[model samples]
Target chain A: MAIQDIRNYTGQITQENPQIRIRLNEELHPRWAHCDMISRYLGHLTGTLDLEKLEKSEVAELGDSVNYVANELLENAIKERSGGSIEICSGAKGHTVTLVVSNRIEAAKSEKFKASLQKLFDGESSLEEKFFATMEHNEAHPEAKVSGLGFLTMMIHHGADLSWRFESGEPAHPGRVSVSARLTASVF
Target chain B: MNEGNHSTAGPETDPVVSGPEYLVRFSRATGTVTFGGTLRLNSYDEIKSMVRAAVEAIGPTGVLTLDVRQLKLLNSSGINLFAGVALSARSSGTKLRLMTSSEYSWQSKMLGTLRKLMPTIEGA
Candidate 1:
């Protein structure tokens, strides 16, 4: 069966002028379809293109990391937005790959998202501790599990840096949040 | 050449639903459990219970060789489950050795981290 296009937004992926860019409209594809495609494409490109400087294992790991990070951000964006579209953009400059996911959400949700960022910062010392803590917390209160493990995995496992923007709401709409992550490829 | 007793996991013998999600084979004679395919939340418990039982049956002196080279796509929760099994083996004085392939980097990265959970984890 064909995939259900729920979002109905246009998406584009371009690699021109020595840079790679992947832009997607949350309205175009399902939660993880876009991420899966981009990661697979990136993996293919790495295998067929100029990524010979990196080892075979590194290329595979990079693809998996990209897929996981993109999926995490996309899922968070969908949950944050009650009645708005999400825009996901990823670009590669040299060996650093950056991903940004943006959406509009309620003020309270924005506040909660920001608070989770602090927990990520605090747990930077031990990945295993953070993972188990998140698992246990999720086991106790399932609601708190949202985006917790995803953000932590991006930081601890993939060695990515995460930053966010929570813009206040306007007169008619809720606040807008944009979470970006910068991951330096561990190719060398 | 020589044999004690060997068992493989499948639809007939293994209780775990082994299909697209994951496949597990336990060898009682050799104390080896091999895992394959993706391990997700749905089939997590099946694999864990199988491993746990296999570890216990192997006894204290036997070495439990967990070969996860073909097992791909383990989510965070699945990794946590694996950590539990590895640590249980450690505490029970059952030697746990992990066999992994060099092709999949996620396995190496995650399994390497799991080593810290069980300091004596071999071939991680």
Candidate 2:
């Protein structure tokens, strides 16, 4: 099969040096509770950042944002994983905190994920409009499988920069995708 | 108001629903549904059902106030659940209000977005 790679970036530009990396094995069948635990841990770690300029309340807010972003990313990864390990990396530089999560998915799902993301990144609607539309859609159709609210919340509510990279055709790992979210320390 | 824990009862009886990390209790006397603790459920099914039941109990022409000041963390799924509840209340001509705290920025911001979506959903 031919190799395929797709990338999309949005929001502020920042370089990342992931200081912490964790991998969750699919064999263990991690539960949803694990996502909450990991996200809380990340939030605690974020709170400890030595950004002296940030006020105590600002630091707390940043930590909460990190926790929310991490939980959403990890939840999506775990829920959509296709028999491979999920990797999470988190770090901070200056006022920006970066979190990246990579997981293996079925090759076929990559297109669907990319399309959903395109709607988020390239659609003509403003983020707020798209968010409300998505919420209304979900409300009207309770049985819809995908809500598409996670990324929107990360961007609109938390003020996080979001990006994604999808690759396929590797011999050992056919479908691998990574999503990165960068958050500024300042409270929104 | 009826503060005791009650199962999914009819419109007259107060319902107190508990999840792994959260509890949602509706006080019929006050027309308020108080959500306390973190709510990061993997899927929206559980929270959706609980919220739907509570809203249904409110019935048409009734006021439904969501007191989320105590809710610490509500994931995107949970946010979506509230959005659905708000729309439902609007369609049924039920008055909806959200009570939030500034301490939890996410809660306030999420509720603010919902308020913007549905202008009738008052926020305090």
- lDDT tens digits by residue: candidate 1, B7-103: 3466456433365345678876567888886553322445556788888888788788988899766555556666677767777899888899876
User: Model 2, clash count?
Assistant: 0
Against the reference, the lDDT scores of all candidates come to: 0.62, 0.79
Note the residue pairs that clash in candidate 2: none
Q: Tens digit of lDDT per residue, candidate 2, span A2-68?
A: 4343444553322245577778887777657778889989999986654546777878888999999
TM-score for predicted model 2 compared with the true structure: 0.88
- lDDT (10s digit) by residue, model 1, range A1-188: 11111121122222232234455554564343344345445544543433435676666666677666766676566556745667666666556566677777776876676676666556456666877565555445534334256666677788877676666885467877767776666865
Against the true structure, whose lDDT is highest? Answer: 2
True lDDT of residue A8, candidate 2: 44
Which residue segments of model 1 deviate by more than 4 Å? A1-38, A45-61, A75-86, A103-106, A123-148, A168-176, B1-12, B19-21, B25-30, B40-46, B56-61
DockQ, cand. 1: 0.17
TM-score of chain A of each: 0.69, 0.87
| Quality of candidate 2 docking, DockQ | 0.52
